[model samples]
Target: MTGLTDLFELHHDGALAENYPRLPGLLAELTAEELVRAGHLLSRVDADEVLAAQPDQRAVTTVITGPGTLDGLVAPMTAETARHGLLLRPVLAGFDSYVFVLSGDDPEIARHQPDLVLCVLDPSMITRELAVPWEAEDAERVLAEKLDLLEQLVAGFTARSDATLVLNTFPLPHELSAALVDRRSRARLSIAWHEAEVRLLRLAGEHPSVVVIDLDSLVAEGIPLTEPRMSVYAGAYLSEELLVRYAREAGHVARQITGLTKKCLVLDLDQTLWDGILAEDGPDGIAVGGGGRGDAFQAFQRVVKQIGSRGVLLAAVSKNEAEDVRAAFRAHPGMPLSEDDFVRITANWDPKHQNLTELAEALNIGVDSFVFADDSPYECGLVRRGLPGTAVVGLTEEPAWHPRDLLRDNWFTVTELTGEDRTRGVKYKQEVARKTFLSTFSSIEDYLRELDVTVHLGVATAAQAGRVAQMSLRTNQFNLTTHRLQHQDVTRLLADEDSIVFTIASRDRFGDNGIVGAVFYRRDGELAWIDNFLLSCRVFSRGIEQACLAAVLDHAFATGVHEMRAIYRPSLKNAVVREFYPRYGFTTHDHDDERTVFRHDLALPVEIPKHVRFTGEIERPVR
Candidate 1:
């Protein structure tokens, strides 16, 4: 087998650029050490060259700052970035200068604007600073002081930079707390240490762009907390193995920040969700919850259910009779998930890729948002070839590893949970009811009127920053400009006196789709610029989008703004809305291959759709 380094070297010519898309799959097959070597090989090539080769791909800059020897992390992190299809321009902070770099004291590092920053901190950094004799009061005070100083540094950095900060809860070493033989004394130190970790976790809640990765949980996941030999020999606190795992997590965060998160999980029913084929073993005979492999399969189902409970749509695709599969789900008492949990279930002998296409169409989302899992290698390979954009999780023979493999890439990770996220399954179910109701009406207008659709539009409050940011990230089909913003970015817009962040929430006879649309606009003198407009794909083809825009135009006219200019950026998925501005009585002021600027005269009198009732307040009396 040829190593990744050899492959890179073999394709060192322009062939590397041609093979860029294939690199991720090849890198995925390598071990951690091999991946790191591949990263080094990739680093030798020019980033601009690789990025320019793929003109359509978006690139993000990242800065990695920490307190120890972090040179070993660059290669692995680069490999991870390559796997994510990002051109990483990484700037590593000097050893023991995490504070200096983040505090803006290091001018060289502070000047570069990055999209994401990962701050890696280990317990040893704080432990080394503790009192020599380990006085309880002294330890507590030092921990508090260090945490406060770190908080100040983070605040200073965020105030100056727009990058999303990634922090981690430090894992406490046993020696530091267990130094005292007495359990009572040990407990005190442990509590104090954990309290400090809690403070670190709170930063994510306080700063919208800041997210804390639970390193403690990662440690619990079997990565060694520390390697004394590495610390003593090379002044490296975190083990190389730990860095490999941490790189994977940080990669996920980078992908999320850049709007590359997978929205759905497609599963193979037989031997994947459960232990055996439903057609052969029957629901009663299929091993599911008693013990051993059955218990593992049940646990995996529970994991899938939990994932579905939080926004990620679940679907099952199997090569079996539809009736038998539905009957199996009905008869299996140990099944953690009912058919209702799934957004779609296709049980037939169709190719999984074709079924996935149908599922994507039914859900009105891109297949790139999907992650497919199956136990058979042949099936996984078929889907991989057929739907290259879809992520495939090939289940191993060991049932115990099923859940772990499914989540290895953090495909459905979100920075924060919202009210909408908690009720996504219920909302999808409501959508089914709405679709069923749609068939009963003769005309689209009559159907919309009968559904009693009402859109509630308002200037967004501070609390809706998360949902607005989520819409900015997840919405692509009906999105104009496809501008990705973080929660802090949305909050900043809300706080700006010259800006209006309008949120659109819809409710009908079925249910309320919470905050499904956001329109970001700013006033410049007498002219208003709509920076971006995003409407959830779930609410497309309805009059809600037009109604929301009509209300916005009315609000601008009421505020005495004569003209509104909106931007539309062309993207692969957002081309469906290419004429959205023109369709709404806006004429193109200027246009090129990249974007079109459309201008609408507010005096033209925009009218909301009669079928859709729009009720909202738009702040008036502008300059």
Candidate 2:
């Protein structure tokens, strides 16, 4: 049985290898025999034993190629030895767990159920065989065969009532046999095979119950197989240190895929469980400070904070004065969180539904990803009723039990947390700052001047692609034609001669609002049509919109384009920007219930505010 020490070692090795390539070389240089020993050590470590010690309830079934399959060996072993006393039920009832080897092609295995079926394909049949190169005709034949097999598998899974199928794609070839060791030729073949595997994984994910785990990425990272020292499985004649690090990664992934957890938690403060308002209690009297009830709440806050650090976004939705909460956060010496911790906060008198809506908007996350936690049953019920998609946890019986109960709900496990997840809260706070700055200025020009705004007008880059796609999806109020695009679509637009996509980023004394706006345009000879135009609401009232319009039009006029046309397609949330085009000197040429099209002559220079400085040089495409 592996302990926490083994798990920590595995995680450290995986992180170091993936993030720092130099670490692998350094470890390899230490000793050739030491690298092999490390690989052997990692392979022997049982990840399920470490998981059992944790307070997790989910069944984690590991499949190994043997006579007794996961059901016969792993399940009973987990149930008997697990530290958390969790029910580790076998997915397969009959025979030793090793029966899964024969059941891979068995129809009964799909019907006669388990919570998780660990299917281990025969290595000899799947991996040991050389991949046949697909000529044009062979490619067609292979696709047809795989598609037919996939359809049958999908149907078999759909017929099952209780089981959720998780399919592991075939692992990468490990043999470095003399026949296969032509390095240069093997690299090209490997790339082709990898692409084929990706397509297979995508096909598997098309089924609801099936989650296709990319076994190749796992193998690339490292996985241990039992074979002779000179054999491909021994972690010799390859990057043994790198492979060991990757095997640990594979183990971590195996645990995560089977773990039961939620994505995010929504919190509320005040009388729910706390003794008094944070603002009034001055942090010390607030139940989260130190001892007694305060100790429990403090423990809860610490737990919640830890969850946030692990990719679960923490949002606050309370019916208190915003200023009071802000003051409490600033001055309360015992306060666990500052204003920066929460991704979104509704510390106003707004209804819980409204707060939740704002919270979802601010985070740019789906409502389903949110799990609302409040000590008051009424508030929880209100949220549950108003936002059906959101998972609202009620603190009905014991208010102090809320934190543990929330944790029991398993609402904070996610497979990956990108860079966007860590900085989301800070981004929202910057948005708040931008909004506050906009409110202080009486006129658009004044707002622009106070901002000391610098508008970057350079051509779009690959880095801005994600932000551009996100703005298109999330922006509602100012979006003219709500044409939601993926990152790839944005990339394509930037490359096309007929279309243009430009980004707008602003920075003032307050802070940097990174890439808050985007505009997409289509050129038709003498006229340029605005396909989509939207800005982050954070930069609203800042005259940045006007600056963007002025800049684009200036480019068009210089390029000998005579006319520019824009359309306003009304949406439920875009009432604020209905007359946006007209205000910018565009004459209303057409209107309908659905859309209002406006046109302006590019020959006439639109009035430009003096404060907004366009710094970057424009790269005009050659005719």
* C-alpha lDDT values of all predictions: 0.83, 0.56
What total of clashing residue pairs does each candidate reach? 0, 12
TM-score for each predicted model, relative to the true structure = 0.92, 0.50
lDDT tens readout by residue for model 2, 1-623: 12333434655665422222122222311232343344333333344553444322334443333211122223223322122212333334343333333335555554444444444322233233336542333333444454455556556544432233444455444552223546755565455555556766675445434445555554553444323452343323223332333323333333333332334577887854355776666545566566677666666677777777765667788888787777666776555666677766678788988878876666544565577878777787677667755766665445567665676434553333444445555666665665567688788667667778766655567667756765675566677866555444676788899988877777776666667788887889999988778887656766678877877887887777889998888764678888888888899888886688899996556654577666555533333
Model 1 over residues 266-369: C-alpha lDDT tens digits?
99988888888778877778888999899999999999999998888899899999998888888888889889899778999899899999888777778888
> Where does model 1 exceed 4 Å of error?
1-10, 130-138, 174-187, 432-452, 592-594, 618-623
lDDT of 2 at 415: 32
Of the candidates shown, which would achieve the greatest TM-score relative to the real structure? Answer: 1
lDDT of 2 at 307: 74
Any residue pairs clashing in model 1, and if so which?
none
After TM-score superposition, the amount by which residue 178's alpha carbon in candidate 1 deviates from its true location, in angstroms, is 6.4
Q: Top model by lDDT, which number?
A: 1
For model 1, give the 10-residue run with minimal summed lDDT: 614-623
TM-score of 1: 0.92
